[model samples]
Target: MDRRDYLARLAGVAGVGLAGCVTLPGSRVTGDDLPSVRNATTSNTSSPRPDGRLPRRGEVTLPVSRREMRSPLTRDHIPAIVDPVFGDDWDGLSLPDDSRAESTTLPGDAPVIGLTDGDRARAYPLRILDWHEIVNDTFGGPIAVTYCVLCGSSVVVDRVVGGSTTTFGVSGYLWRSDLVLYDRATESLWSQLLATAINGPLTGTELTIRPSSLTTWGAWSAEHPETDVLLPPPQSNTIRGREATFDYFIPKYRRDSPSVIGFGTDSNGLHPRSLVLGVAHGDAARAYPFETIRREGVVDDDVGGLPVVVTVAPGNTLVAYERRVERQTLHFSADGPSRLSAGATRWQRSTGAGVSGPQATHDLTRANDHPPMFWLGWSGFYPETSVYGEDAN
Candidate 1:
């Protein structure tokens, strides 16, 4: 199935709806009445399978997902919460670059942060950033902020945009627990899934911190002397309460094939509501809502880590086998089995399903000896397949 058709099928359900506005939980309510699937409390799955699916070697252990439970915060709670904030323009923002030699050092020459090219850089602290690597911090005005509580260093990215020079830090909404501060960018709070902390009610002095990562929170408290860090408050509503479970399986169901999992919700009886399946891989991160889906109790490794990527269509229960391509790489061919050929210097696609239709115009090339890469020759059935690679290389 093609991407457009695959999406149409996934969107067929009567109750489910896309989150149009990037508002927090309360502001926008989806119409879909998808039942809840209370399978697990978090994204951790384990089974005694012979197959090596989990992050660890043993079948009994699965990698925990990098997601956190989120509840809508009261207006009073949000005022002082230290979270990262974002700006609209990409160019105006100050981002880290190669010049950060002393500032971006790790514990043991680990190269925690590195410059990608002209402006962008990647920072990763061995243990500290791993536990709390990806966070959303807010920037106050003019200063771009990127602080690692674990590493105890925050860098201001130097960027020039719209005739104005700017700097940025970890956005408040980066899903980190700390309240990020920022300036001059006008907008509403955008939502993040699988974030470390969802900024909630702000009126009090108490900080709602989780038990697992006390050190991370402690560092945050030390840095912000002027602000108060709040702990996770008691859940007044069942919708926001945290629960735990072991195993959950969505009744072997199929609505549309080639539908990748979109955003999930607390709708299903499982811990995570349901998997949001879409056609084709584009904006895979933004395509599905991690917070909403973790509620349904799927295999922990499957849900938490989002390990497997399969292609299937409605009425067909089994997911089609496909290879994982980074992003932006394309392959086209008139002869040979349709598959994704990787490791090439340039993106050259070769492979057609040998099917006749406008959809057959796309190419696929198998770079391996396993199974021949096949493209379901209809857009209506499967579109969630990964057509475009990440960088388009």
Candidate 2:
């Protein structure tokens, strides 16, 4: 079956109901049209800045020279009107402390973006990110927390790029159904999935990805009770009320939604919608399927020539870490709640710290940049990725 028919059948089997039809306004060009579109230049005429300030467009000498844009999706494929501009520091950017965050009502199963820097931790609920796709906030330092509901990609990036701190806003654009963010400093457009600036000044600049956990609210709260949860921006009753009525976390939407866009079949034979945690080390990339990890509990594998262990703790919290200690690689297997064992060594899942054995005082290095994403989005960017259990299939 073709891609569309396969997804349609999958949705039917899963008993997914389609909502009201709404066509996003944009051109239907594909990757084949990217070459010609690359040659076309955006108008030099200055458009009113999102801040209402008039800055001369195309006048600033960007830090880098303009180069041919390289992406799986063409420029024309990106819709100009999919997202609405909320401008810089849009009204709802508020971060409340633990004491003040008690009033927020969130279900246990609600998905949240869990971030930790040193000892500081915070949870950015999807309910709030759905309304405000970009949250410019600081946790121990400056960072931009972003979520694209369209492609199911959640990324946390450092706000400082090239010595200067830059804030980001939703650029009201989509490339291959993924969110495109614009830096307010130079108005450079960035691809969220690719993590690189594609247009305007700073064309070649890339954002540094920080380690984050995308898991259930219950799991995060239980793991770190003192962590503050992001509440809806003050006086956002209308947006909060509408979000309450919408069930975006249903299994059908996550497992069989038609919003997924990809160029071809995954090199690995797993279903396109399969949830995978992608880990990139140097030039090597690998995807650990959620189905496999849930069953195995602990998986010891090598990616990019480094020994790593992918662990699924209680509450289904997924995390990856380098299993090397004192230059020796340790094999791991699920021992019990938040614990793993490598031979005689027992380690804690939350911190990857060895609890017992010769290396009891040692801690494993975390593969912090790894992000859990859908197979379609993961495979679309890393076509050479090897799925963990592809050989068995």
Candidate 3:
């Protein structure tokens, strides 16, 4: 079917008209209710896998199979920013002056993804990420900070390949609607949500994930007053043009939207846009949905065998910490909106440090691997993932 007929069958908008949006643990999407899978025959250009497939435009995809790869765009369609410049005031930065460019300042509620190492702390605004998916920087070390507009997943990982560091670019390929990136050094395809090279020489090698957080600008700024914010991409003067995204809050799961591509959701169940703190340890992965966290305020659970405590803070920011300190597991409860405690020791919700009592000096280690993500993206990657509040899992 062509685009119009395919779209017309899919609720005539962007997404399927299903009520439930989740899959049970260990379930695969083989139902007839799902949308038809498009045929993708992209070659692995630049660097062939030596196993026949070449990853170029409309050629073939590797190990992932051409059946699932969706090429709505070609490589580098949304250029990744390199040699990024940072400023102290996030609120002060403005989009490039253009009729199609963003004209407003960064929203106080806009979500940013970043990390604090020793004396340096930084936050990359999500609006900027909406335009450019990858930011290759030497912050702390060689790292690629990535966010998928469709998946709502922000991942930071060392960009070192074969003991040498390299930058990454958008491949314009979506593996199940997740961002597919390629290293400048190899042009090998990598999955943003899986954090693995799906094809090429380093195909099976895993990328080391750096700890990061996704929260609102107002909340992040208040916690780290000395934080530096990334400047918006310079306005394009040539064929390239700069554009602005007003919001990341997906209103509906349109087929055109990243969240709903090739999938179906229930009309009354959890929305595909529902955000969750995605946690993975080794091979085991789990999702702590925001809907459950907001109601309980604190979710004490284990993922990949690590004891995790997920809490909903002010501004709807979510923080996860390893509940065990000095080998002793602390049963945590919400002391207030943003504070958690175990007996007399109160933990700083912002930093995961104990603030009072005998073990005040000890700290609950923060889990940087947890990235706040939307359900459709997280569940698609880890169908065996056990949700926090779900009984079936």
Top-lDDT candidate index: 3
TM, every model: 0.21, 0.70, 0.76
Cα lDDT tens digits for candidate 3, 1-393: 432233234332222222122221133233354443364453443355477564432122444654555544546656677767788764444533433435345567777886888878999877667667788888878898898866678999899888999889887666756788988777778888768787655665578988888887888888888998887655311113343322222211232343445635433244456687777777787778787888887888888888889888766767788888878887889888767898888988867877898878987787636577877677666665667777632
lDDT of 2 at 112: 80
Candidate 3: stretches off by over 4 Å: 1-62, 90-104, 235-268, 281-284
Candidate 1 structure, TM-score to reference: 0.21
Candidate 1 regions exceeding 4 Å error are 1-111, 118-163, 169-181, 184-393
Cα RMSD, each candidate? 22.0, 10.3, 8.7
Better of 2 and 3 by TM-score: 3
Cα deviation of 17, candidate 3, in Å: 12
Candidate scoring better on lDDT of 1 and 3 = 3
The count of backbone overlaps in candidate 3 is 24
lDDT of 1 by residue, 104-157 (tens): 212222212211222222222212222222322222222222332211222333
* Cα-based lDDT at residue 161, candidate 2: 80
RMSD of 2: 10.3
Instruction: State the lDDT of candidate 2 residue by residue for 283-360, as single tens digits.
Output: 788889888888878888999888899978655667788888888888888888789988888888866777898777
> In terms of TM-score, which candidate is strongest?
3
